[model samples]
Target: MTRLVGYTRQLAPELGPAADVEALTTAGAVRVFVDDETADPRRRPALTDCLAFLQPGDVLVVPSAVHLSHAVTHFATTVTALETRGVAFRSLTEPAFCTGDEHAVDPAQVLAAVEGLRRRLVSLRTRAGMASAAAAGKRPGRPTVMTPEKVAMAVELRNLDRPITHIARVLGVSANSVQRALAPLPRHPDSTS
Candidate 1:
């Protein structure tokens, strides 16, 4: 007989929907491995326990594909490892990709979906990190070396038809910096007068 095993990353039971647990329970999942208090997958003790407890006919059930992994390569590797151990994978939210079921879905399609989800998750995490940094008054990327005084001097020299190399030498700044500052500023409609 195939044993049902559940897994989750959240610590608190309230954090996960009751419906998800109910679904797993209905699917005959008797054991659950939860990685509470750790965001790092490398430090998940409960997951280790689940892995050690897994039998050849056991099926690992998860609430969603993201719950299994947010990384495409990791997800694929984990699934393949389980398959090699004679264990199956099932996601309540993604029933079509359940290996425990008799329905045969293309492995390539599942990999494509995993890759798409991984890309979207990575993009969202990057955007959130940038927004958080901005909120903390931190600027992203390299700091500008050009000062307003230097920019003004470059602009004046350029307006006087000075050669870019000559302007750069006089200002003691790079030719690239001089050229960038000398670029024409956009005129506002109100400043047309």
Candidate 2:
């Protein structure tokens, strides 16, 4: 008997109106694995569970190829792993990848197509996000933690011959932060001598 299993990383509100499990059930999935409150692809416990529950001849179905993986390499690796385990894959959104279909399509070809599509989609989304951030006058990286005052204090403490650890302790910051804060200071000529 063939088992149809589904997996998803997102939950209720983020998954939108139709629940993922319900949608998977509608798509003929008998069992579903959902990772609750997990956003990181690397930390999907439910995905691991689904993989563990899989048996030979079972089919793993997902709404989209992205649900399997966001990265092309990781997607390919996952597909290969499934293939090796005798488990087939099907993407409801990308019907070409469906192994259960009557049409005989090369899995490699499907993988390539999905990879190209994922790359384009990721690139488009990234560009859109960057453009939005630029429009909002916001920088793309983490906000600076070392303020000018902190830097000045670090420099002052360094000049006073305070150790990096002591300075960090006094300022409630890391020793690495103290070191980074003092890195740009002009060296005293006497100190260099």
Candidate 3:
């Protein structure tokens, strides 16, 4: 009999017991290896052990597709290795990989998977950009805090050997605020300030 393994980045508070219960109730017909408290299956040592535990034609089931990384090369390599071993994949929440014939264990499925991965990468980039903007004291989806005049003054003050504290005090802001405001100014880039 083939096995079904579920991989997750740490079991959910609400779903942890339920997942174990469901796996245990599988009646010993399909050995279910439930790896708990993992970051990513790719990084988990248990995943290597689980892969070794798998026989040809075994299946790995995940709850959602996004649990897998959004890196196309990474995802593709993983899927290819599993396919080479005749180990199938299933996402319970996404019937495409679980039930759809065209999507189930087919090379064409890579396109859809790649597209999904691309979308995920885009979203991750967007979130990272927003976070960096916030750290720089700029609000996301808003006009920049440093106007042209502000940047010019920042460069002028910085060149004048004025300490960041003094500049910020004069500018009516924090030292960090001044640093951030002046960060965009060319730092000797192309010999320009």
Candidate 4:
């Protein structure tokens, strides 16, 4: 008998069983692995065990395709491994991912999947690059207009009893910006006397 091994996971976006066990059992899952903790391969023991337990010719039935893996890269890698191992995939929700020679999925859905993967990969690379730049003491976003020179000029103009609006007009900044830059300066020692 071909084993219909089932797997389920739920961690975020409201906790509870994310996959339907009764549906998997009805779908012919002799053994079902339930992981309530994490999708991280090293952390989730049940998922590791489930992957190890699966054999050739066995069908891995999942309630949804999301239960397969967490990240987009990991999801694709997992699917590729399953395909290489001759283990067919069966999704109760998304049937388009099935290895069976079934004539059902829209061509647009396939294109969307490829596009989504490409986008995710690009996003990951961008994030990594940004982080690398940050670690090297480089800020990623728009440079701030509040330079030390501007703050110093505001302080000197304020000491000379210049109007905040006049100082702001000279600095090409808002009066509020001038006020903010001057707010944190040390108070005059004689003013407290």
Name the best candidate (by lDDT): 2
Look at candidate 1 and tell me the lDDT of residue 149.
86
In the range 1-193, model 3's lDDT, one tens digit per residue, is 6666664333332346355436434523254444454344356665566667766767766655554443667656766688888887766555544532245455567567557757866775586577769889987885655667766777787877678888877767678778888776665343332
What would the per-residue lDDT of candidate 1 be over residues 1-193, giving only the tens digit for each residue?
8899998765232455465667777877997776753356446677778878898999999877766674767777888899899999988767655785585888787777666667755864576567768889999777766689887776666666678899899989788877777566542334321
Q: Candidate 1: where are CA atoms >4 Å away?
A: 11-19, 127-193
- Which regions of candidate 3 deviate over 4 angstroms? 10-42, 98-110, 125-193
State candidate 1's TM-score.
0.59
| Number of the predicted model whose TM-score against the real structure is largest | 1
Return the clash pairs for model 4, or none.
none
- Candidate 4 residue runs with Cα over 4 Å from true position: 38-42, 103-107, 113-193
lDDT of 3: 0.60
Worst 10 residues of 4 by lDDT: 10-19
In the range 1-193, model 2's lDDT, one tens digit per residue, is: 9888998655222455246678788988998887654345567777888999999999998877766674777777887889888898888777766664354887888777777668755874586577669879998876666788988887777777778899899888888877887777875554531
Clashing residue pairs found in predicted model 3: none
Minimal lDDT window, size 10, model 3: 8-17
Candidate 2 residues lying further than 4 Å off, grouped into runs, are 11-14, 100-103, 106-112, 120-193
